[model samples]
Target: MAKKVIETSKAVAIAAKLCRPSVIAAYPITPQTHIVERIADFVYDRDMDSEFLDVESEHSALSACLGAQAAGARTFTATASQGLALMHEILFVTSGMRLPVVMAIVNRALSAPINIWGDHSDSIASRDSGWMQFYVESAQEALDRIIMAYRIAENKDILLPAMVCLDGFTLSHVFEPVDIPEQKEVDKFLPSYSPLYRLDPKKPISMGPIGFPNSFMEFKYQQQEAMQKSISLIKKTHEEFSNIFNRSYGNGLIEEFMTKDADYAVMAMGTITATARHVVEELRKKGKKVGLIKVKTFRPFPEEDIIKAASKLKAIAVLDRDISFGQHGALFSDIRSALQNKDIIINNFIVGLGGRDVTSDHIKTAFDKTIKAKQTITEWLF
Candidate 1:
């Protein structure tokens, strides 16, 4: 293993390279372009041997990956904001078809005014698309999750697509010292893609055909079953990866920091969790009973883990980077559902929309409000 101070995009590209995907198709999008560019470097230098497709659009990129993965090849792709929105239709197709395609989402805000900056709107908007969503807080987690996404998604019981999301510009453009696992170690952890089923001419089987009314609901039911099954598979895969790599993130779902004895806590995902962690520490030093909950996996919701983490706390603040429009924050809604029957106060704070910086002061304010909140409070922290 080697540790290097490199851009988060570079770390993602290198991690994808180490996994040795046979096919890569991605369109250039702001912030996300760097990841594909670095992978192109690997293909150009012959450091990585893969079929790097120069696709025309984000839709085409994921389409190409879907075809490749369906034909028994491990595939990868990436995008952000509009690029992800463009691939919306295919996103459902890829997941519903049960292709284990992996994607990196440099999370960014969707357009109305055409702004391009960091936010969870892109991925959060696709929450119901049947893809296993993994959110990371740093370059290192981004690197590791890409490798783990493969094993978890490609599991025999869970042949579903997965996307690893990281905040754009915030974490993607920043440079940090990350430990890159050796290729052999990664290979040992993640063996080459041996799909149980494939689009082989010899087999000549049909897949993803139109589901009739008789079977449409059944197909949807199966997808839900696999999603539920994946919760355990994700945890197991995380444990196996940590055993070999000696690194982990709170059991590969939700990480609770300093929440053991705290009376109140802050809950959030992505890079903002880092700032929240700092604020929690500062509040701790001041003898405030506060903690932080960092969510690593968004999809499959981690409801039980969330409930367990929020238990015993007097009140909890849920910070979200995306709003559901006319409703509370996207994540806050989920948090409320998880703790709906509990006796604790749950407050929602929507911050960092459309790339606005989420400073520590903003996080401190969420904690301060949460600790003293008497009932459910929703506030915009812009």
Candidate 2:
């Protein structure tokens, strides 16, 4: 692998080329538009070889990917926010059919208030869509996740579609130094995808067929089993990746920063966690026992690690970019529920919605309040 400074979107395009997907269907929206644009340039310039289709809509993009994957081919697609919402219906079918299609979703806040900025709302809202999710911190992480995602999703034991989400603009538009793996090395890391079953005329099989009341619940249970089973496989895949490429993130589940010996900790997802890390260091120097835990894999939820981390801390501040109206922040709710029996205060802070800048000061304030907080509740941070 060679290190190169490139824009995040361009890095994704480079990753696509290395993975050698058989088919890539795309319908681009804000932030993610550059991702498909770079792919188009690669296919147009003939630097990469793949069937890149500019489908009319996001739903069509995912639908086309399903067809390709079901036909026994490695497939990929990308979208964000509204575009992802558009394809919401077909997302379940993709996973329900057990197609290992990988997608790059530039996480952006959903609308009603009309936002085109980075937020977890876009992906968090689709948490139950049955797709394994990864929230990356930087462009380099984005590129790495893409390569690793294929291996995890296409594994025989876990045949579920996976999504690699980078914050809209924050991680997408910003440039970062990424170590680009060579084609041969990537090929060695990820073997050619082999499907258990295919849409071959010789062997006709009914897939995603109607399940009777008794049988329908079984299908859902299988999906749940695959997701839960993926926990270890994901860890193993990340370990393998580290062995081959010398890169790994948070044991393939959760990444902890300065949380080993601390009385209070902060938990957050996406790019904001980076800022919180810095704030933790500053608080450490001031004699405060502050730590950070960044949720890297969200769909499987990493419940075990989170519970263990919160067990030692007196309190935790769950900084979320997305809010669940009437309830609490999505991340906060999941974490609170996991730590329900624990005797610790967990404060949910909704910050940086609609592209707001989540600076060090905002994170510092959250930490200050969290370590001193007495009650468990959700609060909006401005």
Candidate 3:
């Protein structure tokens, strides 16, 4: 293993390189472009041997990965806000075909106003796109999760695509000291892409065929069943990875920080979780019972783990960087669904949308409001 200070984007690129994907296809977009660029360097310098496709757009990028992955090759791609939005339809296609293609998402704000700053809106908007989403707070976690994502996504029980999300510019552009494990160790942890099935000329199998009404429901049902089964697979893979690499991210799901005995907790994803962690520490120093819950895995929602973590808390302040138009924040809605019929007060605090900075002060206010709230509340932290 070697430690080097590097940008999260480079860390992600190195991680993808270590995995030795057979095909790399991605179009350039801000924040996320660096990741693809670094990977291209690896391919061009012969440090990595892969079929690097210079795709025309984000849609082709994902579509190329889908084809490569279906053909029994390990595939990868990366994109930001509008790029991810463009790949929306194929996102379902990749997942529906049960191809285990992994993509790194540098989360940026969606268009309309056209902001390129960091936020969770991009990935959050794709929540139902059938990809397993893992958000990271730091470059190290970004590198580590990319490796782990491959293991989880390729698992026989969970042959689904995975998205490793890091805040654009926040984590993506920032530099940090990251310990990159040797490729040999990574190989041991992640053997290879032994696909359950592949498009072989010898076999001549029909793939992605039209699902008639009767077959269509079954196909989707199977996807849901696999998704539910992934919950345990994710935990097991996380444990195995931690044991092997001596690094982990809270059972590969919801990471609780000082929440066991707290009266109130701030639940958040991405870099904001880091901000909340510090605020939680400061609040504790001031004798306040505020803690933090860092959600590492957003998809397959970690509902049971979240419920268990919130059980002892009096209230929870769910800080969502993305808000559903004319409704509650996506994370808030899911948190409420998980804790339904419970007595604990859950407040939804919408913050950091369109790349607005979520400072420690914002987190502190959310915590204070959560503790003082008599009932569930929804407010924007502007």
- For each candidate, what TM-score against the reference? 0.99, 0.98, 0.99
Among all windows of 10 consecutive residues in model 1, the one with the lowest summed lDDT is 364-373
Q: Please provide, for model 3 over 224-259, each residue's C-alpha lDDT reduced to its tens digit, 9 standing for 90 to 100.
A: 999999999989989998998898889999898998
Order the candidates by TM-score, highest first.
1, 3, 2
Clash list (residue pairs), candidate 2: none
* Runs off by more than 4 Å, candidate 2: none
Please report the candidate that would top lDDT against the real structure.
Answer: 1
Off by over 4 Å in 3: none
lDDT of 3 at 212: 90
Expressed as tens digits, the lDDT of each residue in 149-246 for candidate 2 is: 99999999899999999999988999889999889999999998889998889999877789899888899999999999999998899999999888
Model 2 C-alpha lDDT versus the unseen true structure: 0.90
Which pairs of residues collide in model 1? none
